[model samples]
Target: MHSSSSSGSRLSLNSLTFSLPLKALALTVALIPFHTINASKAYQYDAVVNNNKLTVVGVENPSTVFKDGQYLHGFGYDLARNYADSMNVELVFTTVPDDATALKLVDQGKANFAITTTSIQNIESKKLTSFSATCGDLYSLQKNGLNTQLSWVFKHADDPLTQTASGFVCQGKQSGSISQLASFYNRNVVQAESWDSIERDLTKRMPIYKASFQRTAEKYDLDWHFLAAIGYQESYLKPDSISPTGVRGIMMLTNSTAKAMGVSNRTDPAQSIQGGAKYYDLMLSKFEEVPYPDRNWYALVAYNMGPGAVDQIQKRISAQGKDPNNWVNLYSYLDGNKAQNGRYRQAVQYVTRIRSYLEYIKNTPQLVNI
Candidate 1:
């Protein structure tokens, strides 16, 4: 009886050992389809290795990146193109709203890169991939100097040699030469140093010489830079630069316009700038219904030719079945015998200049001071 019991226990132990392998085999069989499905679902992005096709993403701001119908500019646009060229890839851009969103897209593999005055911080560096080389820092070199350090300068696109630098790139049709006029930057090319200097310069120049003018600009909710840009265009910031067309002072106020604005002295820098700022504010208000890009162009035309001319252009633009407030669509209607005159021609050129200048400021940290 003892021998029979011992044999029964041994038989039971053998059955349990055999059942373990069968369970494991069943589990293996159950997992086979899961493994196969996972393998089939695995996806790979079509990334160009060492190829020049890169997708860059950034914020969609006028200062960052904007589309004027089909035309595109701004530092972010230029930089993406440049970097792609360096890598021999065609650049594709996707515009977002802010840096945090942009970085998130990159991390999620929606875009390969992000560009928009991106600052490399410790936290950010660990979170996402960035260029080994720092980009978007603005610097200035002495006029006529050749130090590979990029500097910001205002130049006509038609100028002979187009200056393409780190932060600012000019596209123009003229053959005139360009020279840098200021060395407001340090030799250090790091992003931090460059950004710091630009902020410092901008702060120092933010205070307009006249407190009243500053107050008025604030009251009108106008950017002091837009006012400054107007001053720069009018007289190149020269308090006494007078146009051959009878415009005077830094604001380039015509005698009639000045008198209308109640400006007693068009030659006084403070008064002229204030008068110009006020006039611009009025023009901006008059076209409050117009779309942006167009509104800016209209304000410029009003500055150059007169509000009457801008109204005429709007009528022509409307007659042509285009939106009068669409600057990109309306600009073509402004050319030729219908509006062919030096005044209109100058207005066209001035609009382009202001657009480029605004683009330059938006991209380059160095020019933020202006």
Candidate 2:
């Protein structure tokens, strides 16, 4: 439940009552501060209990603490978050360059502890630091026979925090929580349930409307596969498809959207594809501050939630000190005041399915010449 934020002027939650238009919102840079750990013994317990912050440092490893888009995710981040939660403290993660730096940070008392994906012995062999560990049983020896187990490296061998971490790690392992977290975070999350249908559609239906997607996307300066992915997600490339809400056709355009895009017929496959591409391009134009692929994702979300709501949410995110322009960061805040639980989940699934479909479309060979 720990979230990172950029340094900015803090805004009062009371002032965020009105919805801000997309064009009027300001963007914040995503930055992780390098916090120096307090060296006093009196600060340790007081910092965790009174101050309520647990700062830890680690290197970015895919299976450990890598950054995806604007947010930190992976096993190390989750483990550290859980450890902080056990102590009732907010987790503050700082990224180092390598395992050696991570261990050094802990040994020099710069961080409370460090999470290592490799063996403690490997790091200990090189650094003269007297670091001890509490977690590693979740992993086995590497194929090369080196111990590649994940562990937490703390400064003092007999610190109270170290012992508590040991107990937590042991309990997590016993409960299969550690292994489950590792397995879930390390998997290919991009391959979703919609893949099979997308595959089937690529062969059967995509060839029929590929030219329309390409022509409209090129006209709008967009990726044809991106347009086609939206097409598949909207109507599964069915020209006659209609939603319960009355949006219909290949791209499932609403009557208003169809007319705005100059489409005469919502059921006309080419016109619908043209309208969808044009509308997505319009969404793309609104998120210029967001970087390429993430901007594309924001546009996709805007397509679902509308640009005004996306703008309002982004403003709320900025007021809380997180970067609003990054989709991963943006997505992390979907459980908003407006839609707390299930409705928020559907919005997340929409972006995920479309993103997977976009990747699938990009990889699949084009069957028709544009």
Highest TM-score scorer: 2
Please provide, for model 1 over 200-224, each residue's C-alpha lDDT reduced to its tens digit, 9 standing for 90 to 100: 5434543444354456668666555
Q: Estimate each model's TM-score.
A: 0.48, 0.51
Per-residue lDDT tens digits of candidate 2, residues 199-232?
7777888778878877887787676766777788
Query: Residue 44 error for model 1, in Å?
Result: 17
Q: Local error of candidate 1 at 187, Å? A: 25
lDDT of 2 at 349: 65
The whole-model lDDT of each prediction reads 0.48, 0.61
Residue ranges of candidate 2 with Cα displaced over 4 Å: 1-197, 335-342, 366-370
